[model samples]
Each structure stands twice: as C-alpha cells, then as structure tokens.
Target: MEFKDYYKILAIDEKANASVIKASYRKLARKYHPDVSKEENAEAQFKEVGEAYAVLKDPEKRAEYDLLRAQGTYRSAGGSYQPPPDWQSSHAGNRTHSQRTDENFSDFFDSIFGAHGSDFRQAEDFQRSTNRRGRDLHYKIALFLEEAFVGCQRQIALRVSEPDQNGSIKQRDKTLNVKIPAGVTEGQHIRLTGQGELGIGGGKAGDLLLEIEFAPHPYFTVDGMNILLTLPVTCWEAALGSTVEVPTLRGKVKLKIPQAANSGNKLRIKGKGLISKGGEISGDQIVTLQVSLPKERSSEAKALYRQLAECESHFNPRQAFER
Candidate 1:
C-alpha cells in the first residue's frame, strides 16, 4: 500500500497542536463537503480529509503513526510499501475499535492502526456541526433610478440547491417576486428570509441577500438622496426672470429662474427629489442653469447683440484682471 502522510493530507505542520489540526479539518471539510461545495471531486476529497482527521485527532493513533514515520520503516519500492517484520503499535493496548462504518478509510490506515484505527466518532461530531447550516447566497438586482425612486416589484429566476428525499442536493428552478422598497441607495442589501440554499440535516435555510445596483441614467445623476439635473436656458431667459419646465423624478415641473441668473447657477426645488424609505424625509432636486447661445444668429439678432454690447461696454466682467 502507498504511504499516507496524515500531516500532509491535513496541510499542517508535524508540530501542529490539537486545536490547529481540528481547525484545519473543519475548514477543509466545509470547503469540500459534497452537499454545498461546487469543487470538482468534492466527495472524494471530503472522504480523504475525514480519514486524515480521524487519525490525527486521536492521541494514541497519532503517536503510533508518528513513531512509524520517524523510524522510516516503510519505503517506496515499485510504488508500494511493506511494513517491517514484527512491527506493532506501542499504544495498541489502548486502541478501541470504532463503530463508524460510513467512512471507508484507506488500506494504508488499516495497516498502521488496525482495521478500526482512530476514534471516528469525534470526527463525525465535528462534521455534523460544521455542515449544519446552508451557505448564504448573494444576488445583484440592477434597477433604474426611477424604479429605486418609486418602489417596484421584480420577478427573478434562479437555480437554487435543495435536498431531495435521498439526502442528495439537486438544483431546482425557483422564481421570486421581490418588492423593492423606495429610496434604496446603491450597494444596499435586501434580505429574503429562508430564500437561499436549503439547510443541511434539517437545519434552517440560509437567507438570500439581494444587493441593489442602479443602472446608468441619461438625464440624471444621484448624490445620496439628492438628484441633480442640468437645465438649459436662453441668454434672455437667464438675463431676465422666466418660468421654465424641468424634468424631475415624478414628472416635468415649472421652475422660476431668478433675474440675472448666470451660467452654473443652481436652483433648488424642494421635495422633488428622491424620497426616504421611511417616508418621513424628502430630498430636494437641484437644477443647474446653463445659458445657451444660438449657434446661427440672424442679422437683426446680431445687430441687437451689438447694441446690447455697446450698452454694457463699461461693464467689464473681467475687471479682476486689471488688479
């Protein structure tokens, strides 16, 4: 039989304490457990890990195995090992046969520590607790800004893992209609209770954490609960007061532009922005004013502009440069 290095199997140092050995076993068991792991050959790997833990967890079995390793009695001749004649475990008198037949330990394990080598009951106890809960699942829901502003219901299709009658995990199609509440910010999570992977061994099912992501919008930008919009206005409209229609989350609304409003001026419309989830607080929509000049001007319009330029000739807007 090939020599099975228990320490190498567990990926631990030879001087590892009992706690480190148990910790490594638990981590590997969870990673390779057939029920939840997506790893290839998970069942075979899990069995190997369990067999390694079984031997290392027992004090008497570990001591006997260590002595055999230290003595180098087994050699790899033609990829096979033969034990020395009259080889016997000093702790064999204290060895107790385990009733665990579920685990098919390797022939190498039986050669060193007899047929029922280590106390598999302890390993089983750890495995049972480590695999009790199902793994939590995360799903991202991409929403438009309007959908997040106002609550909406979305139907999503997912393939979830569930245990069958024979205690084997199977993938089943699941559909869920999730109600997204209003005022959800980016990176927010909406949890669905018991909607994730089914628990192992009758334990409680894991929760599905729905992460909220917003799709890019062409007309608007979001800042926390506030919404920003850029409104274009003619030079006359900015020079003189006017009421213009502007787009908001709800719909288009009229906004009054103050006289002498310059480009980059901001107008605040209260309560027109995104609402809070609690409905107790409301955000304001901020409109930035951009004065747009006509690309093609008529002769009469050019003459009027020249007349206005003559009227404001003394008003040097760049007077600060004279200092």
Candidate 2:
C-alpha cells in the first residue's frame, strides 16, 4: 500500500491545532462534496480528505501516526509500505478510536490500526450491522424582526454524512426549503424529520434542528412577545395632547397622546405586537413617550416660555424640596 501523508492531504501544518484541523476539514469537505463540486475526481479527493480528518482529529491516532513518520518507517522507496515489524504485537491493532470498519480506510491505514486475531471477525460483523439511527444535526438561523412577525420561507444548503452500500460514510450536499412560522422567538428550535445524517444499514435517519435567532432592529426592542418603542414628541404635545404617527410591525398608525402625558409614560397599542404560535393570543405594542425640547429657541419662543412660567408660578414644580 502507498503511504498516505494525512497532514499533506488535509493541507495543514504538521503542528496544526485541533481547531485548525477541524476547520480545514470542513472547508475541504465542502469544496469536494460530490453533489456540488465540479472538480475532476472530486469524489476521490473528498474521500481522501475525510480519511485524513478521521486520523488527525483523534489525539491517540495522530500520535501514533506521528511516531511512524518520525522513525522514517514509511519513507522507504518500495511501492508498498508497512508498519514496524512489531506493530501487530503492539497496541496499534487493538487501538479503538473510530467505530468505522477497516475497509473504510486504505491498506496503509489498516497496516497500522486494523483489527487482528479472533477479534477481527467480531469487528467486521459489528461494522456490518444496520440497526443504528443516524446522528441529529443542529443549525442556527437568523431572521429579521419583520420576518419573524409575519413568517417567511427560506432555502438552505447543508453538508450531511451518508453511508454507501459498503457502509463507508461519504459527505453529500442536501438542500431544504423551510417555512419559518410566525412568532419564532430567539432560541426556538424547528425540527425537520429525517433531514439529518443518513442512517447506517436500514435504520431510521435523524432529524435536523434549526435554532431561531432574531437580527437586531434599528427602530425596535423586544420584550418577551411585546414590541417596545420610544416615540419622541415635543414638550407641547405631551402637555396638550396630539396625534402622532407610530410605527408598528404591521405598518404606521396614528396614536393619541393623552393630555398632560409625561415623559417615561407607556401607552399600550393592543394587538399590534407578535402573535402566538397557535394564533390564539396577540401581544400589544408598548410605546414609551419621550418629551423633547427645541435645541435652539427663538426670541418669540423665549417670551412665550416666560409668560407660561408666570402663569403657572404658584405650581412651584419642586415644592416637595421645601419639606
């Protein structure tokens, strides 16, 4: 068997960290995924990459491979390469890391870590079993506040693991068109049946769990199911009621400001927020009033303020201070 340089196959430094190894595997896996990749021999290259990751991702396997490389055991010029003479007598054969069968790997890999003796038959039999369910996958999706309020449909592509007739796992691309229901809050999970990793043998496939997250909005804040907004108004509007246009998830609506309304006061706009998942209850929009004053007052405005202060002179706005 030809010696396989797992590090070179993964295109990483010999001393690459665990995170770097994992990241490189994902990038290369996507690049050569059979369903999406257009490169020549894409399927073969994809398999090689997966094999490299399986060895490098495991610390024990990587250490053993490194030792072989360090001793120049595999650097021989012969067309075939083999492990040290004592490899079978050592712990390499019984080293249990991956659950995959020796056939999933090349003869070079089998030479180092393959099963031996009476246990070999049991291992082969176990690998052929088809009663194990596939693995479930989790993915996070971000939605705009508007989309969450009214619901939307999205199409997403993902790389999933599948087993061939030989029970060897392969990477493949799967696309799903998903409907995001209205009122999906942050951290909510939407499960799609049998959309995850393919099961071994004839076992059932796993489900895909999509975690929901909300993108930040420039004009609104969320409080549970309620939508919160700070509506700015002139000081005069607060003292002597006025009608103003307020933005809601549905659209803009005219809101009535009660007479003598003060800053920090909250007004509830019923049934204007998010809807319940079952469509039974609707949250109200909470509008908080913030009174604003003119930054630059004209001479006429100053005179009007003086007259108003005089008219309300007995109101000593801070009379409680004297007590």
Candidate 3:
C-alpha cells in the first residue's frame, strides 16, 4: 500500500496546532466537498482530505502516524511505502483495530490504521446502544459566521434507509429543518433527538448529530470568538488619526483611530465582534489599520506627496535599522 503523509495531504506544517489543523480542514472540505465543489475529481479529493484529517485530528492516531513516518522513509508527495509490521503494536495499544465494512476508504488507510479511523466513527460510532434503537446519522451544516451569531433555520435533504412493505429496507429522501442557535462556532455539534434512522419494531429512533462548520467569510477571519478585519485608512488617517465607520454583521460602528497609528496596527473594539447567548462572553473586533494610497495619483497629488516627502526628510522611518 502507498504511504500517505497525512500532514502533507492537509497542507499544514508538521508542527501545526489542533486549531490550525481544523481551520485547514474546514477550508479544504468546503472547497472539495462533492456536493458543492466545482473542481474535477472533487469526490476523490474530498475522500483524501477526509482520510488525512481522520488520522491527524486524533491525538493517538497522529502520534502513531508520526512514529511510522519516522521509522520508514516516506515523501510528502506520497510514493510507494508500507508500514513496518507491528507498527500499531509498537505504539498505542488500546485503539480499535477493526476495519470498517464500508468500502469508501482507501487501501493505504486499511494497510495501517484500517477502517477504525475517526471519520467512520464520527458518522457511525461503533459503540452504539444495544437496546434495539435505530442507528444514529451524522450530518454537516455549513454557515457563515454572521449566520452563526444570529441563529437561523436550514432545510437539508438526505437519503436514508427505511423499512418498506414486506419488512425490507429501501432508500428514501428525508428533509429536515434544523434550528442553529446563536453564538455557535465551528466544530460544535448539535444533536437532534430521535431524528435519525427508523427504528426496528417497537424501538425508538436514534438521534441526528449536526456538525457545525462556518463557511469562509469575505472580509472577516475568525479566531475563536474574535473576528479580524483589515480596515483601510488614508495615509493621513494613520499619521493624523481619524474617526472611521467600520462594518459588522449588526451594522456600521464608528472606530477611533489614534494618531500615529501605523499600517498593521491593530485597534480593539470591545463587545463588537460576536456575542454568546445571554451575553456571557463577547468577542472583540480586531480592526487592523491598513494605510492605502490613492489608486490613481494625479499631478496635484504627486506634487503634494513630493512636498510632504521633502518636509519629512528629518523623519526617517527606518532610523531604528541603523546600529
């Protein structure tokens, strides 16, 4: 079986933290998700991405993969390689060794970690209740950060198996309207009780667990509850400071830029980012000051800039560089 560099597949540094790994996964998952992706071989890419994340997301699996990678020679681009025999035995011994009956995974995965990966367990946990309950179904819900803060309802459709006439299972499309609560962040799971598969005779149905993911927003980048926004300012605005109106999901809020605010300077606005239910915690909006020049420099503007340059000759911005 081919050796797969899980970290390389996810396009992350080997030293990346869990949050970084998750962010990369979410971005790639959205781009290559078979249901929405426009790229060729999206289905295959999605599975590869999923498989890679399945290993690295778990601490134990990641450690074992790292051990195998160090012991054997494997390239990031992924050439032919196999795990040393007893690779699993040598490392963590308490993990499940069962291969998934589902044929959706790769042979490379089966050769080492097998179907006991997190993806399958996340979708259908093997340790389900033995009380004749229906199997729990897993689903993913994508939302913009704005929608997450305000809460919204979504209608999703999925095909599920149900018992038909003569006690045989048949595929049927199921539509569900899920209510997402406010302040929901990425990776949060919401369970809808008894919304999963049809139970057997006189048995209760299982629950549907909706995994939350925030879609990439155009201007805002989320770090936990905090939201980052790059706010553009005129050169004078940075040098002389000015009051500017910034935008949030709620609406426009005025920001006070202090004098001498340099490009890349971050200004904090408390309680303006995102708020949790009952207002327990609020994420501040980090407005990064970005100084911008006019797109087209007119003759007057050019002359004024030259005049300013001459006037500021004594003020060398790079004075600190001189030893």
Predicted model with the maximum TM-score: 1
Candidate 1 C-alpha lDDT tens digits along 1-323: 78878899889999999999988887777667786677788888887888888888888778878888887756655767666668786644545555325455676766666555335555567678866766788999999989998889999888888766434567999899999998887789999999988887445789989999988889788877788888899999999889999989999999999999999999999998888788877888989999999999999999999999999899988899999
Candidate 2 wrongly placed segments (more than 4 Å): 1-130, 163-174, 316-322
The lDDT for every candidate, in the order shown, is 0.81, 0.79, 0.76
CA-only RMSD, every prediction? 9.4, 11.1, 22.9
In candidate 2, position 172 carries an lDDT of 93
- Between 1 and 3, whose lDDT is larger? 1
> So what's the TM-score on candidate 2?
0.57
Which candidate number maximizes lDDT?
1
Query: Model 3's lDDT to the true fold?
Result: 0.76
Q: Which stretches of candidate 3 lie over 4 Å from their true place?
A: 1-131
Deviation of model 2 at 212, angstroms: 1.7
Residue pairs in collision within model 3: none
